[model samples]
Target chain A: MALQLTRPVLRSQPRLLAAAQFLPTLMFATVAAALVELTLLRLLSRVAIHIPDVPALRGVYSAAVQAGTVTFPVAALLAAALVTVAAMAMLPRAPILAIPALALLGAQAALLVAGESALGTAAHQWLLAVALLAVLFYSTSRRMALFVAGVGVAQAAGLAQAASANLAAEGGRALPLSVAGAGESLLLVTLLAAPVLVGPRRWSRRDVIAGGVVALIGAGMLFGNASTARTLALWTFGLGMPLPALLYAITAGAMAATLIALLRTGAIERAGALTLIVLGGFVPPNSYQAGLLLAGVMLLVLEQPRGPATTD
Target chain B: MKWSKPAVLLVGALVIAGALAGLTGVRTATSQAVTLKAVAVADKPELNPDWATWVKIPSVDVQLTNQAVTYPKGGGTVPAVSLKAVHHENTLYIRASWKDQTENVPSIDMAAFTDAVALEFPGKSAVSVPSFCMGQPGSGVNIWQWKADAQAGAGSAALAKLYPNGYADSSGFPEELTKAALYQPAFGLGNPVARTDAAVQTLVAQAFGTLSAAAAQDATGAGMWRNGEWSVVFTRPFSAADGDQAEFAAGKNTNLAVAVWDGANGDRAGQKNVSQFVTLQLSGELVKAKSEDWGALWFGAILGGVLVVLGLAALGWAGVAGTAKERA
Candidate 1:
């Protein structure tokens, strides 16, 4: 009886990892991307004001800003429309997976397009991170919940600071540190207490070493290469300093890991097929990039784990 | 006679492979964009001052912003660009003209914004267009960048010979006051006053975010700013294919994307007005253009080989399984 229970616990670990990490990372990326598009809209509007003589350009700007305002609902409708058609036409074996994914797709898309202002955008991204953490990864363990909350809250704070210049003050002192205005010096000191505030959890030697290395690298990336001082390594969005390359890399790694786990559940192929189609929308691939997709599909097929997987 | 399941499987695999190959061929053929007609000219006209005649590429909006969220909104009502191309022996010349009131040429000055125009070509075929801003990964781009500063620098050198020291204004509201911004120069190299136009540098990069600088300059251009508008002509070799740079050839349509940067708006890297992938067809030439089908061809070849191997394995398994079932 203990052996059987342990097998299931092991099986559920992968699912738990996906819920906690993969979903939140994607949400974070989506929010960042949404912010970029919104920035463009705001810039175009300002330019239009100055160049009123150019009527044709004015029309284009008007159309772009107008279309973007309803970005969430429209994008969700389009996604749902496609999903509904695809679910009907292909008659995919795993409609159950598609159904939940379809709902999340809409919800995620809607939250991603949350507009209003910097506060709203930050709030929406935070809500998304927290919601995904709770729904997907939230467990009975108090430490795990606290850890997830810490990461989510920190990311939320960073995102708000990233958007400070653009959302709160357009063309204001845009240097990342100054983007948040004059209060960063004190706030910085307070925020630094985060790692210490996590409470005393016993760490293994390996854990201690790993944590130290990560913290050092994170600090180096944050302070060493200041993007404001002409170092292009870091991008301070609005006021939040989210490292895009790091985020996307994490997202890709998480997605790949999740797909591997799903292979055991006999759901990877179906999910991968849908994912492949959706990924095309994001990165317009040339013929060579197409090869990566083919290889990925083949790998999923070959590496599928046999028998019922023990679950967590 | 009824066909065995093993035989049926082999035939089905071959049929599917053949159909895929045929469909791919059709897609490749359709991918050939409309050829841009280039007027063969002598000396690839030097900043050919006349703008009345150059056949224009669709002056698409330098559409910016809203693709991402930002505090300050994007899109500086950038003017649509126009294009004219002409080629001589082993050379392709492109003239890009756009409307810009201020002459924001490249400068070392902290606040000087240089106006620039660039032509981006796919490293390979006419059909395999990648991202609009830059060539996507796996596919590289050859970029021919022309800046207004270079043109102005070249003109400044000429102006010295024509009327040297005549327009010299030494009083820059004091160099100390403005922090060493006083533009005063003496004759010869170190003359602070005689900073001739800087040569617009040409660059070759494959993707959107690149930090690498150009080691060699290949293309040359000249720009004229008059009455709130700028016109520039850029020239590069026709068959200069080396490394990651794409080769431009006569009689073949090369998929190309254009971008114009107005420095005034802090447009660098991803910021600027851009155009969708368009075709730049050079009309006549000495050498016929080679095809850009290698990428697709290799992909198909590998796929075909895999299918053949899988088909063989399937057939063998079917045969063994069939015999076992019969025996049982």
Candidate 2:
């Protein structure tokens, strides 16, 4: 592993470097902890938190309860933003992750918010497309990522909304419009991933690990449950467990290999921390996934590498 | 400790699953079966309802939609699946049959999906079975799942038989797509059908993974689709390594559940119909399962695909940080 020492960069400004080193990681940990805490609360309250819509007061209370759901994650994002400001004040390179990390955190908060609303739901898909692009190109190829973002904005803002409006005027046919929405989202990801995979970037370890973990989780969900595994195997694909497993595995493995290649080829700088920050907010396997992501980010930012040994 | 957090996470998943399973103890659904006078083979055409002795288990109609956030839009009701189970010559044979309009087996195209069936049994030897909903995550269930395309016999050259005009040019078909070995059923290396050449595959699982492929496939079955119906059969050894799995012994009573997915219905993952725990009478006078309220179906199909997506990201991260040196 290569170390980019911040202390030298901070020789004239130690306090700034110290803040840089701690800010992102601490913010990441705080966000991770908050997500984990929310998971715990949600699990514990799975059956307990039903707000009925009846009397005006009850409806108001229910609406408040629903609105309050976004409180924690948004707060975590705000705190991270504050910490980013603190870190950026001292270290110029700080806040490298804050941009993309906050974007994904905002996306997650959108889901936490009125995710069921039409526009909110629509935006969620676009955000996911952005997140996948983060997994693929974040530090490895910012140019490509930026380009994809540009394309996504143009497609979603101008084309998709217009298509929705045109279809809505024709009598609100849902299935076709929904399909269009899904296709747009799917196309965005395919576009984001394909070029990056074929580009000059080398393999990134973060991408590989994240891809592999997601595949593993899919496999677990598929094979872990007998009913699901069987339906997909027999009725759905006509292939057995192997086909589905291979599907997820190959998708993940390809991303992993591409990421690894990018890393080995030295295509970019330390996007690993940024990647982890993004993952910490989104990819949760029981809340600890966020923890693991934060822990990875912390190890890099907090624990500076030592100098080579000197002989006596 | 390095393993503490993940371990706790795993425990939390299990506990939550167990608690959920405990909540559904009151639900029960059954699939009836009669003994077979003769042995049954996976691809054997002679194995019909009379030979297998069919017991029609009414619709497992507990269904769910794409609400899980995986597939965008698709869902339909599951027609009842006819189930048959018998043990002959050290093999336990269980067959599932259901009605489907289209045989959506070859999935090289869009909106194409094959039919599938699954059986869940307590992974333990005890009479006390866990809930049918995947045994509360880690509580463990030895599931024998049979997918249609993966089945043998009737599926022989099935693509050629079904789609004479599926392609525009004869030579246009890719050669690599022709071999079964290249399939890599589930996630294991090599092929399970190397010796048997059977298509109906039986896979085992404990919980929602990122799960690994079973080391060995001890069971097999084949699917036969004709006139808008599919009958798939499963045959496994009468006895498996006991303790944390269902016993396949003769004359033993056990509890099991059945689930079916009509692929065209956009049914996949947790989005399908399922049955509650039903009694499987292996010997003597038959004991039919008490058909309680069918409402339990909805309780089981409620899904969470987000966790699955999260688990995938974690897998990729693990790949990068595979070793301490790598992290360094």
Candidate 3:
């Protein structure tokens, strides 16, 4: 009986520790991304000479700098992803792993160069696809899960800060409330599902309770703000949010959840979940384009013969 | 090795394509040209020497002349004399001629007979007239003048009104020549003097001198002469308007000619005379001629070429990058 109790406690301890470690990485990634973005903006101002008005150029430069600053969390995840991939590649000694790893790195580079322009709906979908592929090719389930959870948390924090900053700059009450509502909804959903996806298969009472709390808080925040709540209700009623914002929100949520899950479960399940979530967001309103991609990934995952399972 | 060959070929092709695109952009940018031209009108006396020529600009082919014709106190005014053949670029000049009929005309009273000239440009609706006259060779000194409204009945009254001392219709007066001298002490024309033909000539010479001084002060002032003859040389090449085309007119007949030259280079381009003469009822009127070509294409081409080069460079870079990626 003591052994059983100790085993469960020990299993949960690593997840908690992993979650803690991932948080700082998320922060670092956020700062790095922001710095890179700011640098790009400065460079663009110096080089792009077509701008006629000095004030307009200054405004654009400032906006670029702000966007760069907001991109830190995403940058952190990218860095973490790279490091994890590198570690995995070293452990497996597979030359092919380098290809996918390099591709991820390339995608991150592209995202950095493109700035906010790259965060459009199409780009988010592409990133989602890449993440899914990475998850599949990952040597260890733990690393994949950790990647997802780390990305999710970082995205949540970064987007929340961005939305807040945007609201403050706009100097209006309504926009802030609406943005906060959306961000909270995203945070709650991501944090709630993350533990389930990344934690051990047999969830303990604490994990279940944590998930419930997160869900409750997230759902409450989403519903509390009348405007955002109305928007979501509209979406629920078969209406849809604007494509770009919706894609961004969904991608951010998936990344947060995956990162959280990775922290908890030490498995790659969060990666697949993130992929599904992003794919769902990418599907056009009243159309099923993304469904095909999702189906392919699912098929691939299912085609892999089941390996023997061991009790945790 | 096989892929490398294909990649190298692709890169080469891209670079070539980029270069071509850049050249094309450059060609389009430098395609348009713009031009501007300036012209000058000669003094009226050069067109008709009887009139005192106030200003002359040879570079633009302008000549102006002014003269007073006297009528011997007799029956039926002498038939208006058609003086000289005024060139198209030149205008006939005229001045108000006064008579001192009073034997006891005081030196101060002689101020009423102030001699003044009126110059009219063909295209301009208004005339230009000088008001007060100072002593000959005097800088900024007023020599002789008449009270306001002294010469109101003259044909160029509107032109005369532009002068400071000339009669202004708004001021209630008989609009006739007044014995009171309109000399301003500020301009050094305060002392009254006896009215005689010599006085008139002195006044005329002084007026010409003042006008010449004024023109010298102005950036656009054409040079003038004390005698009725004056010429202007342009610093740059210029073209004249058709009405400003150098011409000679006497009574009903007029001859037109094109004047071309560069004052700076001391090159007097050949003058071309027109075949047809335009006859008008009026005498001593101003005419102008305008030139056709002005050079501005060089600047346009230079600017366009620069833009094209920049655009081409960008396209080249893109192509090079694309080619490199393909090869890789």
Of the candidates shown, which would achieve the greatest TM-score relative to the real structure? 1
lDDT of 2 by residue, B1-328 (tens): 0223433443344334433433443211111111121223333332443342343222121122222212232333653454545555556666677778777665433566556777777765433345354553345667776666555333436656656666644564366764434554532345443333555444445434322234556666666788888777766666665555566655465666777767777566666666545445453223233234322421321122234234433443443345334447
Better of 2 and 3 by DockQ: 2
| TM-score per candidate, chains pooled | 0.36, 0.34, 0.23
lDDT of 3 by residue, A205-232 (tens): 5544554555455456454543333233
TM-score of the B chain in each candidate versus the native B chain: 0.58, 0.55, 0.17
CAPRI level of candidate 2: incorrect
Worst 10 residues of 3 chain A by lDDT: A1-10
Judged by lDDT, which candidate is best? 2
The TM-score each candidate achieves on chain A is: 0.28, 0.35, 0.35
How far is A89's C-alpha from truth in model 2 (Å)?
A: 78
lDDT against the true structure, each candidate: 0.40, 0.42, 0.28
lDDT for A228 in candidate 1 is 20
DockQ of 3: 0.01
For model 1, how many clashes? 49
Candidate 3 stretches greater than 4 Å from native: A1-92, A107-131, A139-197, A201-204, A229-312, B1-328
